[model samples]
Target: MREELLISRRGFMLAGGAALAAAARAGGGPAAGGVPNVVLCMTDDQGWGDVSYNGLKAIRTPALDAMAAAGLRFNRFYAGAPLCSPTRGSVLTGRHPNRYGCFMPGSPIRAQEMTIAQALRRAGYRTGHFGKWHLNGVSGPGKPIAADDPLSPGKMGFDEWLSVSNYFDTDWTFSRKGELEKHVGDGSDVIVAEALKFIAAAVREGRPFLAVIWFGSPHSPHKPLPEDQKAAGGSAYYGELVAVDRAMGRLRSELRALGVADNTLVWFNSDNGATPAGSNGPLRGHKATLWEGGIRVPGIIEWPAGIRKPATTDVPACTSDIYPTVLELAKVTVPNQITPLDGLSLVPLIEGRMERRAAPIAFWHNPARAGGQLNTATGHAALCDNRYKLHRLPDGNWQLYDLVEDISEKRDLAAEKPEIVQQMKTELLRWIDSVAASYRGEDYRRAGIPFAPATRPAGPATAPAARPRRQQRQQARRRRQ
Candidate 1:
């Protein structure tokens, strides 16, 4: 890929809107009109390359393609974690899932953390959640959630909800505001249709809305409509995606029809990486790993009134940023936000004032390893520092990749760049310590606390060699005391 093509979109936004970008830096207006109506749409297991805009020719995603063409496409967007539940936690709270003990797909989010929905509701925005909601500590097939379920969406700040426990397909049953309702038809389409009804009500009431439409298509049990499957030439996975695209098309169109398209900030992305039957394009690794493919997925933001122009960016972003970004956009602050949030607002980026991410993104899988001290001998952990990616392996070794040159990560640059490895490793380990502290509720209710690096004696900050990395880190903590 040409370097120019990879970055031309960002170039256009930066160059064309220099004044707007400058004004934004001056705390100028995405607030000029009032904050936008927000819509968050996420798909289950959609790959980074699933959409035609990213280069899938087998199945056409006209709706998604249109949205991509008319919005800010994220060339390097990522899921907060490789699994669904954890990434969902990050999106709602703007913190790493491990900070609240949401390690795997069925892990529950802690009650102490503040969610975007809750904050938006406090801001007077109508809040609703539709489709698969797995953060309620439930497993197995998708089922109706009881209103009394402590972890239901109603309990988490959404005023209204039509959701289930996990993945759902056509003819699915949903719990609408905690009432068991069996909905017939394509599940993707069904959820969007329900969301539109909510959106229409909000529009009629002259209120802004935060409608979260998390789709259950393309995950498994590919039961796409016959016409959609036929359109994909008999590929069930692609067919499911085809339906997802159609659902999004209708969503955008309906927003336009309601005369709210320009002011509605619509975000489209995926819960995690692609499944085996799907593709992640050139990215390596699959769902449940720390590689680009596992965490990276299709992402786009379309707010016609707020965006200076349609563009794309290579800057690395993830689901964790959603909470802070939306909050900042609405100018709402969480008074009791869990401390040490892993994300920052993307309003600057949206306004074209951000050329690069301000901080590196840290990703770790299997929080059980993060119990007392980080156990590196199991699961995966990696950090993305702009163009460079670092993985601290289970065997207590480091692997590095210059993503700009090698997106597939076929080569390790750790041997050649020892200094960079040492510096990033120090920061990564320090971050791990902070996360562990949060896990133990050390930072609970201490909203807005900044992430601080461990003030270790310089030479001892990074994990030592000889002993396993995890064990040595525990030993270092004991020695410090």
Candidate 2:
């Protein structure tokens, strides 16, 4: 795509209004009204019960708890996948992580995929991304940056980005434009501060904005800000989360103070379920699994002007819903060239009218190995159609779960429920074939690399070096898996 294809900030909003009208017409909904500003706050690796509202006794997340009480909490909300990059990718693309070639952590989102930012940009929204941006750079066991990777937030549609290549703690480097600037402060707080600035500017300009504030908190290398550490008493991990919570409080206060809180559809969620340090409440699996604990996440949607009930809904929603949800709320239209969104909008649920969720949610992970980490692995896929779930792993592993009754997934009913499993497996395989055919591989780091000046490989002498590269990738995949 050419840079000229980019919709200007002003034109994007006008287009969004048009797009909303179109979507409304297509959905047979009432005519669209003024678009709502969107604020999507995602915490890294935050657990379901980490917040007090979710029944955590230790962590003090007053702001999040209050937000939950003030809005609609999704009792069965889930991330698009079990890992960060994949879930984040789903948020942007309105599709399964596998479709966008982001099936694992540190993988790049396909440059060809249409991102939520890009879609919203077409509708005239001022977009900005803050915090972790792991969809760029080299994926192997090296620390060097890939200068030409086309998967950064900028390429994905955000006009302004103050982000890191991946998760960072206190006192991190900010990738501004093409250069890096050292910034002092807790990573979570810094990201929120930047987001606040973007929100402030959008408000001043009288334009609808989509500000994605992704906190790099509570992830690994758990270093908490001093004040937050103190607040957590003795646990530094809890301290990092405390910092994120406090910063979130500041963000909400600022939004309300600026009079945008009522108009802004503020959505808070995590990329996936918790890590070992955190709790997934009653859920089963953690991080990289097909179990509920790996995908189920705490989610809240706060819009004072719209959702007046402040209710809880058992309606199953996934991270994929974010892209279309924001687009629908903002009155943004999906361009003709853009692929159809795999996610259904949750506007009806938000409006408190939708009774039962009908569509199935699907998940798949196919990790690729490179150097020393579990770069990636291959897994089939799974889908939740209403109450039943069917999983088809690459190793021919298949299982079925009755999510409503057995959210833990401790027992597999596939043997007894052979008919349902086969039906769902057929559906899953069809999707897999379609998606895999176009998946050329997510080596975004190698995208713009020059072809070694067409230099011939040093034949026999280089054979041993090639073997080591393969071996290193194998080892990395093992560690990650």
Candidate number with greatest lDDT: 1
What digit string (tens of lDDT, one per residue) describes model 1 on residues 19-78? 333323333222223988999999999999899988998898999888888998999999
Error at 470, model 2, angstroms = 20
What does the lDDT read for residue 71 in candidate 1? Answer: 90
Worst 10 residues of 2 by lDDT: 454-463
TM-score of each: 0.85, 0.80
lDDT of 2 at 469: 63
- What is the C-alpha lDDT profile of model 2 across 358-452, one tens digit per residue? 68787777645333222223564678876887877667778898988987787899999999988887787666654553343322223432222
Any idea what lDDT model 1 has? 0.80
Model 1 misplaced stretches (Cα beyond 4 Å):
1-33, 369-378, 445-481
